[model samples]
Target: MNRPQDHLAEQDNVRRVDDVTSALEGLVTVLGQEEDLSVVLRRACLQAVQAVPDADLASITLVRDGGHYTATSTGDAANRIDQAQYDAGQGPCLEAARTGTVQRVEVSEVARRWPEFTAAAGAAAVVSYLSAPLFIDTEYQGSLNLYGAGGDGFGALDAALLELYTTAAEAALRGARRYVSARETVGRLRTALTSRAVIDQAKGMLMAMHRVSADQAFDLLVKRSQEQNVKLREVAEWFVADVLNA
Candidate 1:
């Protein structure tokens, strides 16, 4: 069964498909300017926040095991305390992650439902909460939350917008994630290739030092790598550096 206002969420989700084309254009242009992940997530979160009018304090959370970890925040006290709720394992963030749906809590009623979360939030001056789930296909992976100071933090329309923004974030995150992973992998491979050369030079040194054959020296290197539980390239780097620097 759908929520009371599911239709509105559906509309927002459809509208998001259109809105993100512009958002993605901005993202691609920005990517040329800077390639940092924080820069990327920050820009994406800000876009999502602005796309949704009711967001006062916007945040993104990554879901793991029906729990949430703060991905980014709008630099607000309420959103900060929301991080505490995730740490405490009790809050609207968890609820949204668990159900893969929107969750809203007014400040006045929060004390009764989430006593601990509310108390901690009171110290931070947080009074209202709304979160929309972010999904990749049928799998719910994360959420976007918006905090109001208190009272009617989000209306039906606000929830709809929240869902839209969450979807947009999901799309942008997927794109960035792929690019970052590929880039990192290429970097590691390049480094490893360099290390391989250094190791081969070190192996030659070992062969001369022990009066051993090349195959025997290589066996020694592999055995040492297993014993130390470090990468072969690390051992090679150290060996070459010692010889060169000595």
Candidate 2:
């Protein structure tokens, strides 16, 4: 026969699983509504605190150009804790990002491993720490971190839940990043097209006014651009504006 405590534990596990599922669904909804990666990450951090057991604070540690920084955090304490790691050049968050694994430990246990980080975290009243690697791509490597004040620290179940959450969060972030990149590429193409049209107009005006060939007209615009220390597009735009206003 099953014990009463075992039954209660099973119930708790079911509730925790439900909470994680709801959090993941909420994240997907937020991702669709928000295009900014920072906003999405902020929401994710807040949700992580709610979804992960024993989590008091959360933050995302991002590594770029061989340097790391806290991209988004739940509160000042989390930021301070993350800064301690950055200053020390070693911490659970950094280790998770570097090793592409989950890191969970009690502050007291890891004192010797990360003295400065543990000191700062202990000062902040954060006892437990959990971090899961977030692999978006080569350009964007990071980890989602959770800080807990509870004495028992995070359990195996907590780490499993966090891994699931980070997996969903990573997919959302990758999609958002791709969307942003595509939007930027489209904006650049549009600007290029507009500049080309303006330059073509300027070339047409020069061809008509100076009776010069298309190549000669383009050469003239280049010469003016060099002389004025301005971009060819700017010179073309100015010449076209001058002729139009005349």
Tell me the tens digit of each residue's lDDT in model 1 across 140-204. 36666777765556776667666755665677666666777799999999987788788789799
The prediction achieving the highest lDDT against the true structure is 2
RMSD of each: 6.9, 1.6
Clashing pairs in 1: none
What is the lDDT of every predicted structure here?
0.71, 0.89
The residue ranges of model 2 lying beyond 4 angstroms of the native Cα positions read 120-122
* TM-score, cand. 2: 0.94
Q: What lDDT, from 0 to 1, does candidate 2 have?
A: 0.89
Residues 69-149, candidate 2: write the lDDT tens digits.
Answer: 999998898999999888878899999999999999887666978887766655677778899998887877799999987
